[model samples]
Target: MGELIVIRHAQASFGSDDYDRLSDLGHQQAELVGAALRDMGWVPDRLITGTLARQKQTLRGMGFDKAPEEHAGWNEYDFHDLLRVKFGGTIPDPVQHDRKTHFRTLRDVLREWQGGGVEGARETWTQFSARIASARQAATREGAERVLVISSGGAIGQLTASALGAAPEQMIALNLQVKNTAISRFIFTPRAFFLHEFNATPHFAPKERAHLLSYS
Candidate 1:
């Protein structure tokens, strides 16, 4: 059986001008997860990452020096742009700066976007979903027994939801709950793909390290 391990990129600069890069704590979290995987004797035959700085940086921090294939299909949807489009070209101050308010508003906006309510967005829900499917196909191709993929929460959430034959709203819920550097595992064959785990943070599960767990 082939195993596909998808990792959500570590915490990003949530309220910064450039949210595509990982924060200092994000790097630490990536390193810790890398160590945990290595200790578990889990090594991937192939490495893949979305064409985003945070995704790529997470892979690097994980101590994998191998050249990874870059796939745009795994890239995250633009939530900022979606928010702007949804609210007449401006993101509310509370949503922009407050984590609680941001996610609360994002949840509602994502549902609206999925239902074809949000206009002037770069990618529609169907298109975003399609690309994630394509990316999954590419990652699970024959030849690699173990594949590691680094992606953002939205793409990973959508992928996991689709694998479980779940509704779109479940993706949003999963997205909000995924912690930084969390691992989601899938077992696959030529004809079937099954989700083995979702949003697991074994690296930070210890009481001493629990404070490192973060969702952003």
Candidate 2:
């Protein structure tokens, strides 16, 4: 058996011009996560990340300088694009920055996208699940004892849900719980993969690093 550590990218510049870039606090979050890993004496035998800029930047901020094996399978659905597809040209600009409105919009967008509302979207839920499964299979086949993956919440959530035999709605719930730079762990064997933990934020425990928490 081997261990798979999945990390969600740190907080991006949400509601800003560039949503794919990390915020200042996000950099600090990444550094703290890296330091926590170092403190725990954890070093990955293999590293993987999605093609997204935030994903790559989070890994770099965590002090893993060398380029990771990039995989499009780990990429997230484009929420903005999906919204455009669902609402056509009527989508309103995100001006309020209210957390409730932001997440409400995200949820509605995801629901619509999952229901085949998005046009020109590359992957469906089924296709996305299969790709992530294939990625996991390939990674485990390499016989690495410890592997680290930096990916988005949706990908990680779907992978975890599939591994645990959860329903699609459960997967969506799991995705929502994932915090920026949070870690989820899995124990993998040749025959199966078991989730050990999900959405863990020990790197920024409230008592120790309260200042590091940032939703956006």
Candidate 3:
């Protein structure tokens, strides 16, 4: 049996030209998560991250000094590109930097992408799922007792939804609620994989850090 901990990257610069970079608060969130892991005395046998700046930076900010192995399969779907493909020059600019509008747009984008609206996207839903499954298989084959992965909310949400046998809509809802730097734990045996927890934020439990609990 082995334990797999998946962490969604910290806050990204929403409404910015470059969303791949983490915001200042995102750094704090990553540090808090790292502190929590340290307090738990967890030392992962292996660390992995998606090929994204925010994902790598989040791991680094968490005080993980050693370079983590990059997995392209862990990369998130390109939301901006998807939007363009879906709307064909009709995609609206983020309205007023409003969180509600931003998320609504994201949901629409995902819905379109899932429905095959995106052109030249790296992977379809089937392909994406298979790729992630392969990644998991490879990680388990490494024979580590504990493994840490840093990725994006969409990938984590899809994985969780698949594990729970949820519908596509359910996955979208789950994706929306996943907090930045939140940890989801899974227990895996040779025969089965069990989700022990999802979207847990023990590090920022106090009221003040409540704002740190954001998915996007």
Which candidate's lDDT is highest? 1
The TM-scores, one per candidate, come to 0.98, 0.91, 0.91
lDDT per residue (tens digit) for residues 1-216 in model 3: 899999999998987878899999999999999999989999888899988999999999999776688887777766666665666745576532677887888787677666766666656766776777777776666468988999888788887887787887677888888899999998888888878999999988999888777767
Relative to the true structure, how large is the alpha-carbon lDDT of every model?
0.94, 0.80, 0.82
For residue 144, give model 3's deviation from the true position in Å. 0.5
- The local distance difference test score of model 3 is 0.82
C-alpha lDDT (0 to 100) for residue 77 of candidate 1: 94
Error of 2 at 15 (Å): 0.9
RMSD of 3: 1.9
The 10 consecutive residues of candidate 2 with the worst lDDT sum are: 89-98
Per-residue error for 57 in candidate 1, Å, reads 0.6
For model 2, residues 1-216, the per-residue Cα lDDT tens digits are: 799999999988887768899988888888988888888898988889889999999999898755589888888766666666566654576522566776788776676666666656556656767888877887677558999999998888888998899877677777888889888999988887999988888877768687787654
Ranked by lDDT from best down, the candidates are 1, 3, 2
Q: Which of candidates 1 and 2 reaches a greater lDDT? A: 1
